[model samples]
Target: MMKNRRFSIFIVIILCMVSFSDLKAQAPANDKASVKTFVQHFYDWYNVLQADDDFTRKHHLSPFAFAIKERGNYFDKPLRQAISDYFHKPLKSGETGLDFDPIAAAQDTRSGFQTGNVKQVGNTFRINLHDLPKGKSEKEILAAETFLVVVAVKVGKDWKLANFIYPAKGNMSQTDLIKLLAHQKKFGY
Candidate 1:
């Protein structure tokens, strides 16, 4: 009777361990799915901004605050606030396009600019974009105008845009871009 009781307890412990491992394995998949959904929604929001001339910067960009970081005095303000200031600042008389178009260099994903599905690499997710048009010369297509890599980081329960890395011209990360903006005193208010 004693031996049978010990065996039953051991079996229960093993089963519980197996179940816990299974749960742990499933958690990452769930997180990935959630992050992917968040990114899709973010792009949708970005598209809407393109059409509206008076789009609210804070309203659109604040939710991803967790994704932005300040380095030294390069950016003393919060990421979203800094971006809002940058967008709302007055431009010089001759400056026509002072704003950065997030999707300007990227080929439309709906039109086959994206190479593959979003890939999770370590803590960051990478989305690749190519600047290829329909009837470009072989050299132009092979040369590839620009290769844009958008990176996202998971912050707590949400995912945030971390950087837009452009590899052609020595690879500029979001932090680097913000630093340039700060240097130029583009961040306002």
Candidate 2:
């Protein structure tokens, strides 16, 4: 009787361990889906603001205005602080601090955008944002311009924007939000 009881207990313990191991293995997949969803929601909100004539006309706000206003909801502390400081700082004579929208990576907003491949490395995620051309099929979005790459990191219970990776433009090399902010200050731009 005693032997049987001990064996039963051992089997239960083994089963519990296996269950937990499986959950651990699946955590990354679940997290990846979550990260992808979070980015999609952000772009959805951003694009709506961009297309809203009343919102833009009434407030005279840029598309990034929402992100800046509710930064704490979208950005982690480090990234939030960097962007806030850069925008709020007074410019020197002849200094034009970032002329383009860093998040959109363009001077003019497109009619729409689509989220593309989302790749995760460790806790960081690189989510592709592609410009969706008018009258184009969903298949064509893959070939469309990759305007921005959002870098997101898990912050506490939620994912937060860490940086933005913009593609190379004419005369301007590929750059990120952190690097651009630092460069502007370093070169007195």
Candidate 3:
């Protein structure tokens, strides 16, 4: 009877270990889903900016300032400030500006659907968005455009957007763009 009880206890321990390992294995998948959702929300916000009037656009983008102010790192503060100024100030006629494009950035080159993968680099994750193919549904097209890359850093268990790069002129990463922006004192100190 004693032997049987010990064996039963051992089996239960082994089963618990296996279950925990399985949960651990699923963690990556959950993380990916979360990252994808974050990007999608950003895309949705960008779309609203594109469609809305200047006054409405500023109101829409104002919330992101809170996110940047609250969670952004040292480098991200200037970027956030620049974004805030852009929306708050009046637009100049025929002035071209940079913004995240969801369609061109997230579309799969072959599939014409939004597709991307998260690559872990040190403590950061680089989300590389693919280009959509020639033909696709309007809904899919509206879902994403010109957003090329997004950099995320893990804060506790949650991933926060550190920076994002748009494929304008050429493929420029956020790190590169921020470096350039830092030099321009007009944007922020």
Candidate 4:
């Protein structure tokens, strides 16, 4: 009888371990879904405003900058502070603040931007934003060029925008929004 009891306890322990492992696997999948949903919602709302020239001009807004300023709550603390510091920092003679929209990495937008792949490493998620082919979705754009990458960090059970990563091109190395802001002295913003 004691042998049977010990065997039952061992089975229960094994079952518990299996159950926990399954739950652990599922947690990451749920987090990925949550990140994707959040990014998609942000881009959908942002793209509409980006395409509206009249609204932007009337409100004296650069679309992405306006979004960052007005919706500051959506960003992670460090990135938001970096942007605020950059914006408020006085420009030296012949120096310029950021001229292009860092989110889209362009001065003009065509309303074709869409959230592509979302990958998470630890607490950080790298989400690719791609420009869809004319009249076609990004899925149809065979190797669609990445416009920019949005970095989001998990914060208190939610995801918040951390930075925008522009991929390397030509002689320039890959750089992120915070780095760009901090390097104003070197790159002139």
Identify the candidate with maximal TM-score.
4
TM-score pick, better of 1 and 2: 2
lDDT of 1 by residue, 17-75 (tens): 99988765443766655655655455454444434444436445422221232221222
What tens-digit string does per-residue lDDT give for candidate 2 at 1-189? 999999999999999999988765443667777887898788777777777758666777666765688656788788787777787778999998888877777777766767777887656888888888445665787777788888988877899989999878778788899998888767765
Estimate TM-scores for all models: 0.44, 0.76, 0.45, 0.77
Which is superior by TM-score, 2 or 4? 4
Off by over 4 Å in 3: 1-29, 54-115, 130-147, 167-175, 186-189
Residue 30 alpha-carbon offset, candidate 3, angstroms: 3.1
Comparing 1 and 3 on TM-score, the stronger one: 3
Which stretches of model 4 miss by more than 4 angstroms? 1-27, 133-138, 185-189
Q: How many clashes (backbone atoms < 3 Å, residues ≥3 apart in a chain or on different chains) does model 2 have? A: 0
Ranking by TM-score: 4, 2, 3, 1
RMSD of each: 11.0, 7.4, 11.0, 6.5
Model 4, CA-based lDDT: 0.79
Clashing residue pairs found in predicted model 1: none
Worst 10 residues of 4 by lDDT: 133-142
Task: Report backbone clashes per prediction.
Answer: 0, 0, 14, 0
- The digit string of per-residue lDDT tens for model 3 on 80-189 reads 56545544655456643434332233222223324366666655566765445435554665466535667766566665666665556556434434443344335433
lDDT of 4 at 72: 87
Model 3 alpha-carbon miss at residue 56, Å: 5.4
